[model samples]
Target: MTNHAAGSIPDAANTLVSENGYYGAYGGSFIPEILVPAFAEISRHFEEIRHDGDFWQRYCALLANYSGRPTPLTYADRLTAHFDRAKIYIKREDLNHTGAHKLNNALGQALLAKRMGKTRIIAETGAGQHGVATATVAAKLGLSATIYMGREDMERQYANVFWMKRLGAEVVGVDYGSQTLKDAINETLRDWVSSFETTHYVLGTASGAHPFPAIVAFFQSIIGVETKDQILQAAGRLPDRVYACVGGGSNALGVFQAFFPHDEVGLVGVEAGGQGRDSSNHAARIAYGEGKPGVAQGYRTMFLQNSDGQMKDTYSIAAGLDYVGVSPILADLSEKGRVRFAAATDAEVVEALQLVMKTEGLIPALESTHAFAGAFQDIAESSKSDIFIINMSGRGDKDIFNIAEGLQDEEWKGFIKRKNSQFEDQSR
Candidate 1:
């Protein structure tokens, strides 16, 4: 690994927000008027504390002492050898505390809530990683935490739900709508409407209305900042192309922000193409479907909607990416050709996950496997000398149960059933 002075890096403040939350024609606060003051408070304090040295000092301290920072940039030697000529590097965000990069923003938001004197934290989660991260930070900071998750998600990601409850968080399951992330978001917003006084909503992703997309991106920028520095030091040059999987675009935007101004570097985001782009089961918002401008879940962005203007159902093997809409910033970037968008089918993602585990001895989250699939395809068509870096957004542990079922591993399922039965009997 190459070593260099970390203090010499350029400040990324200017990259945080170039506009008042609009990343082109998209992104604006379309929330109810009753919630206007809550958004304003978040905007005012975020603007002030973002530049405060003491605030950063505390944030950085937490990152280093608590959640591991400067996560390794691992050169996938074995995996790279599988390709004809391209070099591959994985930004191992899976190694972060709580086994994902979600903690970075979770800690920052929780701290901001503390500064604002909010005693309660509420959030909407899909894969449950964000909820667990939020709950972890809330427990640490002595904040009451409540997480809204879809009933289906709670079952699929029961491991995360269990941890969130163990961490003293109250997990509520929403059975309405698609009974997924979208429904959970609606429930969280409804809760915020009445609890805005004593509670702060820790939105899980970089989507949502004004202030949220920008704020989440600002906090998650740590991933990109370190990636830039680490890659520059290791290779003495930036990678030719950077890849990240876009769920609500938190990890994608996090790693893309630092490279946004670097026109020479290409940024590609992988969306979940569940069955195929042509099938209605996919979540490839920008890649297919009606790419019209609309408003949903408090933000004006491109959504999967019917002709009647109602949001359509979305699906993905990766629960985290199963959403009807994407981040407005991502929508604008994809439209303007600043960032390229690609998609991988669920089958392709599973194959990629298995390939990475076998070749690199590292298991990637199913969500991140989409990026692997896209990057591999891109590398296959590109020049041999090209370098590609993919953001490994999370670990695969949380996905073990779902993956086992997907792979039809009867042995594993039987073992799980036996263990679950024992737990139930003990509880009685």
Candidate 2:
């Protein structure tokens, strides 16, 4: 590993990508042969644009004009009393144009695609939010767009599917493997390998190879910048706790960026607990196992893989938060104990969703619910002298129908039948 001064992350950060394109042994492209040139080109061009004022000027202009940036930092009034320890605040990235923090990075990469003179964009999406965001930008930029989604998710996230279609993008549903994010990524990679000459692959998270992880983080760091300023403006001081949900970990990393240098801010990442960590079903990677370096989904990172190196089955009620491996940088941070990681059960996420909608009049995406669940813990444990902030990563409109549908699954049939039988006998 190349050495740099501790805490002095390179100002021109992309230049610091190591020989293997690592951010301290957490990132690298371990892809097939066909993707080398494309990834290398992305890395090289990304480095060139590291400090390009003109590029940023245009980017900033778009954010102002189109995306409504400098998203609000809102206080969660009802949660404050219940948590009792700290004032709870939120960085309302959920209110972004595309409804999640994914757009911040997607738009940034889409801008880069324009700079690269690419005419088409391809992306792999889970929960379909990233695909929708990518397709939205590609439409706005008048570029051709294609999004690959897991076949199962295509059904579960039908609203996002409709959004991508409305934005004039072709959605290819992949049925391979587990029919999930990993499979969608495999399909997108196949397309990238074949069409790299003219297509830009817009990865949605900060977990890919070297340049991608760095680039996505840089773009999404707007969350941190805005949050820091907004929190100070609203609360007159820094928040004591900050929370964000982790999938491939972009949103968490984005929000965590501004606070990394602050020892006082307690950074927490809420991983998906499909059932529970101890149960067979869970997406709780960090809590369940030691995160060793391994390759999956084109980047080498910390994943819950079996002894044979195959990835383990991941489970989460939130499709967007169901990835088996987390971003390598997050793994590093957790390993160093710089950040605290926690798990939130699906039941807890649903409860948090209900609480936010009823009290805050906002419906948060299920993926983001993990943050609220964890922040609730911080709020509950605190003594009302502290402040907690949760990154409300997206609106929950897309998840409402799916979440409701899941509640009516075959598993509930027995309960339904017993309740109906009791009611019928009572009437007789």
Judging by lDDT against the true structure, name the best candidate.
Answer: 1
lDDT of 2 at 325: 83
What lDDT does the true structure give each of the candidates? 0.88, 0.81
* Estimated TM-score for each candidate: 0.95, 0.90
Q: Per-residue lDDT for 76-115 in model 2, tens only?
A: 8876655456887878887789888888888989999988
Off by over 4 Å in 2: 1-19, 406-428
Pull out the clashing pairs in model 1.
none
- Cα displacement (angstroms), candidate 2, residue 267, comes to 0.8
Error of 2 at 401 (Å): 1.9
- Model 2 RMSD to the real structure? 6.8
Task: Tell me how many residue pairs clash in candidate 2.
Answer: 7
Model 2 lDDT, residue 230, Cα:
80
Candidate 1 residue-wise lDDT at 428: 100
> Residue-wise lDDT of candidate 1 within 168-203, one digit each (tens)?
999999998889999999999999999999999999
